[model samples]
Target: MDEVLTCENSRVKFFPIMMYAMVMGMSGLTIMYQKAALWLGFTDMIGHLLMMVSTTLFVVISLIYLSKYIKYTPMVKKEFSHPIRLNFFAAISISMLMLAIIYKEVNVNVASMFWYTGTVLHFYLTMYTISFWINNNQELDHSNPAWFIPVVGNVLVPVGGVGFASQGVLMYFFSCGIFFWVILFAILLNRIIFHHQLAVKFMPTMFILIAPPAVGFLAYYKMYGVIDVFATMLFNLALFFTLLVAFMYKNFIKIKFFISWWAFVFPLAAMSISAMLMYHETKDVILLSLSYVMVGVTTMVISVVMYQTVSHVLKGEICVQE
Candidate 1:
């Protein structure tokens, strides 16, 4: 009985990290899938593949976390006890259904029916984020500050919603949202840097934190075309600098088995793709070509590194002592 209790305690301790990783993974996958959808013309086989991959991962992780965390008390089992998680799960389901509905509209009145359902889905996600994630964060006991990633990611959902609903009204709103979250994340990045002065000495967390919003800004541009190219490009440039520092300091060597390393690839790739799409629209031939080339090349290189890191971590070759 005592051993079983000890095992349960260990599981509880791991619950936070597992939840954090899963949230980050979901965020990365969502950003990647949006780009993949664009790349494949939204109707291509590749788009379907990307959607399937992202959806499967999200659902699986959510279920796993739910199973791990949901209480089975007599009162809770009655079905009204876990409203937040249940509502989030429901929002994801509705969002998926709406995405599928939009998928069938490709080339058939693309603009008219497309944005409404997507906007609704985004709003639902935004509601869930505000009502559940942020409100509950204080309740979760986490050692590392990295847990804030999901919170910021959740907040950005509304910007996407607003952008989708009305470009004129929502464009700056979306950009402001990106700016806000990036600032908050920057503070978190600094704290991580302060503490882990040597652990991730080679890799700076700032770039990874900034990459998503950069991607978001570019995505918003593609959706609304309201922002200046230089502004968005500058954000990406900052990200590039951060990545450069990370590679140089962290010894950008290939190590098989770290899942978190793969996390880096998705954001950069999505941003590159968004930049490419924006360049095409702005008629900047050189920049467009550069974006495409970098997207492919960097993804190829980073992917190999991420896969190796994952393998190493899984095999216990690169353990980080807490």
Candidate 2:
């Protein structure tokens, strides 16, 4: 048991592990304002308060991890080539984009700045990740839903880009994201079905499969102001995937708690938020009820994970490499 814990501890570096917290915290805020606003009723005071808390937490965490990265250059470099670690860059981009979305109503100038910065950074990161895929001799057997991270960033661009960018620009990013989602989805699905079984630690990331479509649905609605057929398809697929993964809850429970469990949070939050948006468009009580249930589930899950993470940190069980 000691050896196993030690081995797992060694893999927990600063670059990406903290991103789990950043994404979850930000997603909570997004759900509170963007989706929850529909059912909970929005107020400027509450919106600003939630935004400030989530954004402050994200900025502080980013600084802490970045400082650690600079101080431990050797370790950072070593982890750069790691397939899973590479996805951390995407988390950074996505966090920035989330900030853009949150800030859009609060401060357009700041929101625009974050939107552009995140879009550009995500574009570069997507290229880098794809280049790594092509240049490295790594086998597709290692491919997992995490690969969707960078690609999904493209789909997410329109979520904030709709407000700050031209329709043409939003389409460019949206098209790119949707295009990559199709390719990566097929590859990842094939791998999961026929390739090697994912290790227990990575099982949580399977929830990532739910994100692109959920996010895409939200992005589409933002851009087009309607839940057209394409948008409906995206939400439906996300819903189906959510149910599919929920059936595998036993698999996730059997695994030990890790920071990667945060992977489950944002996707679930996205689905909840998507359902909320769907309720607004369709005025369907069923969709509204589903949104409420999802909100409860997402909150409970993140709360538990956050508590466990803090407990682990206090016990000195995290962020130490073997």
User: Backbone collision count in every prediction?
Assistant: 15, 1
How many clashing residue pairs are found in candidate 2?
1
lDDT of 2 by residue, 69-137 (tens): 767667767666787778666877788888888878768999898889989999999999889878987
lDDT of 1 by residue, 1-322 (tens): 1221223422432322222332333334444445545653343564456455545544554444454445423322322224322222333433332233333334334323434544455455445544764565533212122332333333333333442345554454355446646565565556555544423321323235545555566545546556577656645664575456456644544322333454455345545655656565666776656665655655574556545644653554442322
Q: Please provide TM-scores, in order, for all candidate models, with all chains considered together.
A: 0.57, 0.90
Strongest candidate by lDDT? 2
Query: What ranges in model 2 sit over 4 Å off?
Result: 1-21, 42-49
How much does candidate 1 score in TM-score?
0.57
